[model samples]
Target: MANVNEPTTNYVILTPEGVLHGFSQVEPSEQQLALQAMLAPEQTMTAHEWVERYSEIWLDMFIEEGWVEVVDKAIIAPHVQLDDFLRYVSASLSGSRRVAIGSDEGFCLAKMGFTQQEADTLCVAAADFFDFLKRQQQRGWAVHGHAISFFSTIDMLMPNTSFIFLWINNQGYWIIIEDEPLLNNRAFVELVWGIKATGERFNLLAEQVLDKKAQLESDQQAQAEEQKK
Candidate 1:
């Protein structure tokens, strides 16, 4: 990583179009400066490696909650430690997507070519949760029909990390949370489809998978019980 304050050494960027070189300038615009930082990994990582890095972190979250399974498949043996995976997929997928991280610190997304495995894993998860989300939606979770485009999901790839994403349309809005995937298998789905969730690892994992209706119902029940006391 090069300091923005000083000149960055020669670097490359893996963009949606293709791999590109950075432009040398006496004073790069603010956007170019920011872009240099965003493309940091490309200076070292190939497109496939970048996607693998992101997927590994995202999968680790699910692994913690027993939502996913991992087979080493390494020629030698188990190579995946917390930081290292023994065998890595050699090919990068054809499509491109942006993965960004958010917190009090700030926000950043990696622009890279995604792998097929990465796309499949998320698609499967999103489809699974979409079933539950559709059920809740019919019961008035969203505006009944907001014409939302289910493009791609941006998982907040940090453990015990909390993030807020707001989607606004002509009809209404949705506040989606993507926390560690311990609540339920559908957590990845919910996070993918922009469903409301209590992304709290402190609570029982079962209790954490509350759709909008479930969450509201639980709140009402708690309020009623409190009144009785």
Candidate 2:
């Protein structure tokens, strides 16, 4: 017998397409409260029985009141090149004033509507913020292992503008938008997948280049040794 008066937990559901939907519990109605009271001490009533009984009183009400509805997914085509992906993401986030992608090392890879200096500065700030967040997580302040996204007000950029920072696959994504309604999960999913894919692709390329360079160095050293022999 759990306390029915306790606050219900909030739920976040992520669809396959990368859209995130949040559901919050509504306040219990008089009838629902009465039903909870009646069932409070009823040890014989199974969990299923309680749920079934409550559904009869509240399910129809929720449906009639339009409490739930489907959200259409934003279709984003897959992009192989990082430039193409960033361009597409910028267009999709039409409400945003500026968007930038950068590495964990504080180097801006691509940006829209931001000077190179500004973007680089922002990327460095984001890297510092991410390091702070990781330290907090290590200190037991954050229950999750890592932070996915966060919002902040950036006075450095604009007085009333909002900054959204997303951490995906060791890449930092910055979105600057007006202080209105923030970007929804539908568009968010695209950035998540896009960043992940491009990050992995470039990382692989970097690894290959490093491997080739190491091989060349090894061969040059071997040649010098043979000449001495």
Candidate 3:
């Protein structure tokens, strides 16, 4: 099996020699069992069994050593300004919590937020980063910042801009903001932590906001009809 640290779109891998896939009890059902049996005819291990083995191997080999994790989030709302982005970045970095910057762009950047000095260091690094993007341009790659723009380099670029780039730190988490928002609001952030704290699960936070927006639209239409009457 491939390492757990690396997630791939295709959970199953078929080689002429053998078929490989991970299994876990998190999805314990007869349907899952039948699928597993079909996939691995020899061992016919249950999904839960496979997952347990996979997780055990991961813990033994690649358990993240410490204080940083970059998680992905959904992009379901308008983007924020560059100023607001920096503020959130500042707060995340000042604390020891694991911070992540996700985007609707497709990938997310996860890692421990950096301090002012570290951010400054990244600014210096951005020069080189920009240069790298320039080279990749010939192949259809371009460098963009937080906001949408025809320009290739980022300078006072708008926040919540759409583009793909890798954000790295000394930790295991990294972000590749491609099509999602890097969440940094207090209420939302707290909601995320709250979910994490209670081991509760939910889909992307922005989706909830979108749902509320839809409700508001429906309500407004009803009010308009009453006013006409």
Candidate 3 error regions (>4 Å): 1-115, 137-203
Query: Between 1 and 2, whose TM-score is larger?
Result: 2
- What TM-score number comes out for model 2? 0.45
lDDT of 3 by residue, 111-186 (tens): 2344445434433443444445547665785433322312344663433222223221111112212223333343
**Model 3, residue 130: displacement in angstroms?**
4.4
Predictions in order: lDDT: 0.30, 0.48, 0.33
User: For every candidate structure, what is the RMSD over all alpha carbons to the true structure, in angstroms?
Assistant: 22.8, 17.0, 17.1
Sort every candidate by lDDT, greatest first. 2, 3, 1
What tens-digit string does per-residue lDDT give for candidate 2 at 20-64? 211101233454342322212212233234346655445344334
What clash pairs does model 1 have?
79-86, 80-85, 80-86, 93-115
Best of the candidates, TM-score: 2
What value does the lDDT take at residue 107 in candidate 3? Answer: 27
lDDT of 1 by residue, 49-135 (tens): 433445545334434544333322211112122111101211111111222222112212211232445433433443444455557
- What's each prediction's TM-score? 0.18, 0.45, 0.26
